[model samples]
Target chain A: MKFIVSIKMVPDVYAPFQIKDGELLMDGDRTVLNAYDASAVEEALVLTEKHGGDVEVVCIGSAKASETIRKALAMGAAKGYHIQTNGDETYDSSSYAQILASFLSDKEYDILSFGKQSQDTDSGLTGGMVAQLLNLPYATNAVGLEIEDNKLVVKRQGDSGQEMIELPTPCLVTCSNDMNEPRIPNLKGIMASKRKPVESLSVSDLGVDATALEAVSKVTSYEPVPARAAGKKFEGEPEEIAREVAQLLDTEANVL
Target chain B: MSTLLTYVAISDGKIKRSSLEVLSHCKSIADAGGMACEAVIIDENATSYTDDVQKYGASKIYTVEGDAFKQHQNGSLLKALTKVNEVAQPSLIAFASTEGTKDVLGALAAQLKAGVVADVSSFNFDGTKVTAQRPMMAAKIMGNVNVTGNPVLVSVRSGSYDLKENPATAEVVSVDVTVESGDLRATLREIISATGDTIDLNEAEAIVAAGRGVKDEEAKALISELASVLNAGIGASRALTESGVYDPSLQIGQTGKVVSPQLYIAVGISGAIQHTAGMANSKVIVAINKDADAPIFEIADYGIVGDLYKILPTFIEEIKKIKN
Candidate 1:
């Protein structure tokens, strides 16, 4: 069995985001592997380790994405693949799905995995779109996964509870963060990652017409949410503070 | 053929409030465009929610009833939606942003060859194209997006729009959309419920959340007591949830659940940017921490500079006295 996992590097959720000249300033912002995508990579690596196969990490981004792919490689992925994008162009979920489906068509894989969502946009669309594009059996928000008798069994989080699902080998799953605790890349793993090969491909190389990859939606503006002003503060004894806080919430905040 | 359609999701045999909100929004968009507002419901008893959706201004309800929809499989759902599309030919489709419908909307977008504007917080119509404002970069930067083509699909974030009462008569029409046996590529095995019968974090009106400052294991019970007293959901920051101090389902942060509760009480949380991003949208925020300079105070409407352990007990006592 061979596994292919789609990963993304997003702005660190803990860092402050800034807008410059009416655009999201990504160049200077700190980047980290999407937390959910890291869980996806962990799930894929676990499955591959159990089933005697190799896991390959893929992403669609600028040159900086190589670091993200390398992070996955350090976490035990066999290799990494980067689909270089033309800078300054934002692609929607549909275009990204189309490109990934086209790329996977020529390759053979038993399973495809993706993060449940990206923290940046939180669209949670790519994996399902790709599954639809490929017409494959798919599941999302999987908290549990197992491979048995050439079938993929998964437990996914739903509205009310977790639903267990069983699909065929050639299936796709979007892993929720709870699927597993992502392993940190150790010093030896980082050293080994330096020796591992990372392959790169442009849209043209993947046979996708660069001009045809137009975004379905265009961001007309980017701005920060207005900051809330600091209000009254209560100090001193716990009793005094608690009473003041409660009174303020009930009278002024109107939320009690 | 130009229609504004909203997909009404059924949970536990009822139309969710978030779905009704989406329907209300869709109706407004339809009114603006001079189009009809319709709703598509897929359930064993699809017509059951006709009155509910109609109350939210849906002029017509499309029903697709079958055991295939009893357990929501994306393949079966797409087929039913495709059938509805063939009949209605909606120019625009909308869905409520939820864990239950996100993947379905994604698959539907690919099947219909339509572009999707997902998790939109607000919408603006300039008599032609609908521009949606959505949060990007973890609610730090807002992205104003324009959905250009026909049959554009969007998922409105929960609580983004109010559910308006438009009181109208909606015709219930059943569509003959059956799932072929061969199309069943996935099979439901079982369902596992999460622990604790507390209110869901996303659905809670008020939340009592704990952060890393609650050092001891016994503090969880203290927070739980406070939550019960306030009739609020119990939530925790990633530091607590990831460290096995609390259930992961109750984690509220950037990588966790994003909530817009009417009231939020943070105990012992030195608000990281990630945690703040999730709860900043709450109507009123109160932070109780030992550190006077905890970042949570930046957005908190009320701040208590003291140990949460001592403060929380007194706070609960005060609230109980007021209630009594």
Candidate 2:
């Protein structure tokens, strides 16, 4: 079995961000691999460990994305594929899906995995759209998985409850944090990653269709979210605080 | 501009509130363009919901009734929706940001060769363009998106749009479709129930959340008691969920579920940015923490500087007394 995990580099959510000239200025912010993508990489490594195969990590970003891929390599990926793009290109889910689908169409891989949602965009659409483009069965928000014969059994999060389902091989799975704990890279693994193989490709190299590359949605402007106003504060005995809160809920919130 | 179509999600023989909210949102977009707005419902009891959806301002309702919808067969549902789209010729299609609708909308967008905006908080339209305000970077930054596709698709975040009762007489249209078993690539095996009520955090009216300050599993009872007194849902910060003190389903953070309840009370929570991102859009927020400078207090509408263990029980008692 062969696995491909797609990862994205995102700014730390806790870091303060600014909007300048109608665009988000990521300047001075540290960028790291998306936290959820770590679970996808870990799930792929575990699958490879059990089934005796190699795991390849793929990412779509600028040249710096190789560093993000290197982190996955240090964790245990055998190779890395970076789809090189400029830093400012705005590709919506459809265009991103088209790029991944076009690249993976000619490649021979058993399973393609992604994080359930990206920390930056939180679109949660790429994996499913890729599956649709490739006309393959896919599962979203997978928390558990097991390979049985030629089928993959998965536990997925649903609206009302958790759903256990089965799909054939060559399927796409978007892994959530509940899947497994991602392992941190040790000194030995970091040293080994320096010698690992990494490849880069462009849209022209893959012969991607021009129509597929057209972005239908673009960010028109960016703004910092308005901070909530500081409201009434109560500091007193527990009973007094409770009474005040109860009164506030009744008068202001109307939830009492 | 052409018509707007909204997918109304139904479960357990009734329409979900999130879907009605989206339908109302779609109606506003349609009215802005001087076009029609319709709703598509795939369920066993689609016709039973015609009057309910009409009350929310759907001018036309397409109900595709079958057993396949009982378990959310996305492939079949997409096929039915496509058939309706071909007839309706909608320029914009909307779905609520629920698990099933998101799944279907993703594939449906690919099949229709349309552009998509997911989990939009708000949207505006001129004569020619639709601009969407999306909470990006874990709700830390807001991005104004301009959609320029021939047909646009969007999934609206729950609680982002207020539900307004704009009554309209709806013309019910029945869509007959056949579901081939062979077309299904996957099947729902079983739905394992999680602890507590089935109300998802995204749809909860009120939420009482706990954090690492609660210390132990036994301390969670205080939070639950407060939630019960307020008739709210129970949630937990990522720290408690990651520590295995609570189920991940109850987790609220950047990596977990984003929620927008009418009233959100954070007990024993330090208000990490990631956790606040999940509930910052809530209507009214209240925080109870021992530390006066906790970040949660910055966004809280009401703040109490006290120990939650001491504050929660008395708060619950006071709320109960007031309610009675």
Which candidate leads in DockQ?
Answer: 2
Instruction: Work out the TM-score per prediction.
Output: 0.92, 0.96
lDDT of 2 by residue, B133-172 (tens): 9989878888899886546888888898889889999999
How high is the lDDT of residue B36 in model 1? Answer: 87
Judged by DockQ cut-offs, is candidate 1 incorrect, acceptable, medium or high? medium
Model 2 regions lying over 4 Å from their true place: B126-128, B196-198
DockQ comparisons of all candidates to the true complex? 0.69, 0.74
What digit string (tens of lDDT, one per residue) describes model 2 on residues A1-256?
A: 8899989887776676677888777653478898889999998889879977789988988888888999999999999999998866767877778888888998888888889888888888888889889998888888788887867788887766678888887888888887789999999999999999998898778888767677778888888888888788899888888888888899878976
TM-score of chain B as predicted in candidate 1: 0.91
Q: What fraction of the true Cα-Cα contacts (under 8 Å, chains A to B) does candidate 1 also have? A: 0.80
Q: What lDDT does candidate 1 reach at residue B142? A: 81
Candidate 1's chain A scores what TM-score?
0.89
Q: Give lDDT: candidate 2, residue B85.
A: 80
